[model samples]
Target: MRKIKAQLFISLDGVVEAPDQWHFPYFNDEMGAAVDATLGQADTLLLGRRTYDSFAGAWPGREAAGGEDAPFAKVLGDARKIVVSNRRLDFTWRNSEQADGGPAEAAAALRAEPDTGAPVWISGSVSVVRHLLAAGLLDELNLLVHPIAVRKGMRLFEEADASVPLELLSCETFRTGVLNLFYAPAAGPGAGTYEDAKTHLPQH
Candidate 1:
């Protein structure tokens, strides 16, 4: 089955909204390379309605301009996109589809359709991601935690779902002070290391 790799640009306080306003000061060539690498790794993009609309509106125009961003724009424009939305989505973008259902069910059904090996990349779709996390449909999460705290934006996990345990896969600190934390869902039960520690201690 194909894995769902969810990526987010988050602040120190866990805010995941409007990164374009604060994310650029910390963006560097290193981070750009990482982002580009991620885009190259995915053949499919999973998005929420808002994100799908935003990208579909902007990236196509960017691709048409044939500028420095044109290559990435073309990549995004050509990739298969699955948008989760209850609203009717008459998508004009190429290779786009809509799932008028719950996020988990839609994502699981997508992943189960043969082994593509390439991951399904989900970026900037927090609500859908939360649902996927709750349903254990997400295979990996990549969070670019910036040093600044917006303090008052939409949070990534604002009681939107139950707590989901994650196992750290990798951590990289960029030159611009951004922390890239990669994680996957913890496998099996009893994942907590300090559970019932009193019983494991010496019975003195």
Candidate 2:
């Protein structure tokens, strides 16, 4: 099966909303380069309805204008995108498709694709992430935790029936106080540490 890699920009308080507000200011050249490098590893993109609307609105135009000439716009225009949305509408972007069902269905459809050896990147999809987590469809998670805390905003992880354990594969802190953390599901029962316990550790 192909791996599903979920990446997010979250605040210290676990807020993942609108990172452009508090997080973008700290995005230095090194961080930009790193993000570009990370994007290069994936050829598939997955997104929730809200996030899909946001990205579809911005990227298609920017990509057409060849604006920024950055890795994000470039790859976004080229990669295959699967947007999960119940809303009735057709996908306008080339190489993009609208998934009419929920996360589990979308994940299953994605897994059924022919082996491409490229990862499917889930970006800015908290609801989709939660559903995939519950369905055991997520293979890996890469969270970029910014230092600032927002008093009120959307959260990265909300309460579920029970806690799902994940093993910390690696972590690192950038000079801008952004911490990059990677995680995968625990191999067995009682096989993983809490997220809070690994907060201060440097990335591997």
Candidate 3:
């Protein structure tokens, strides 16, 4: 079996979409190192269509950039990437595949399949992450919470079909004031649906 983990770049107010518009300022060598470490643990990527397009557009060239992120770019380019989309897409990038089946079922099937020990990673795929949560297929959730609140953008939890409970696994603060929060689905008392988790979120 494979472990599915998600990593998100989010704001204080929980916005996860379009981080490119506001997330760069807080990035630094420390943050880049942290991200590199996370990527090192995964050999497979499970992505939604938009995330796939965004990465396919960017990382290919980075692999030859010979910089701190070059290794990560190489790994990303070499890893087996599975994109979930209803419509067919041209995968101009290497090692990429398309899975159009319903998100939850397809992800579940993928989980049951064999693979290398490295985990399956999901980053910046809000819809895919939501379906993974709904299907209880996610083994870990990592949120890099920046200090600024963008005031407007798509949120990570806005349209989830059910509120899922997550138990804290770890929390670390960076010099840039970014909070790295790690979690797993709740298992003990207080374990409940995502609705149960909403009470803990900031109001819009």
TM-score of each: 0.90, 0.86, 0.87
Best by TM-score: 1
Total backbone collisions, model 3: 5
lDDT of 2 by residue, 1-204 (tens): 777879888888999988878887878876776577566566888888788888888877876786575446768878888888877667777888887588889898887778788878888889899889878899988888888888688897786567878999998888998888998977556555678669878889
lDDT of 3 by residue, 91-158 (tens): 98999998759678767877888866778888898999987887788899999999999999889887
lDDT of 2 at 92: 79
Q: What TM-score does candidate 2 reach?
A: 0.86
Report every candidate's CA lDDT. Answer: 0.88, 0.81, 0.86
Clashes of each: 0, 3, 5
- Sort the candidates on lDDT, descending order: 1, 3, 2
| Global local distance difference test of model 2 | 0.81
Deviating ranges (above 4 Å) for candidate 2: 187-204
Better of 1 and 3 by TM-score: 1
Candidate 2, residue 187: the lDDT equals: 51
TM match of model 1 to true structure: 0.90
Q: Give the candidate number with the greatest lDDT.
A: 1
Error of 1 at 6 (Å): 0.6
**What are the RMSD figures for all models against the true structure?**
3.1, 5.6, 5.6
- What alpha-carbon RMSD in Å does predicted model 3 have with respect to the real structure? 5.6
In model 2, the clashing pairs are 171-202, 171-203, 172-203
| Local lDDT at 51 for model 2 | 86
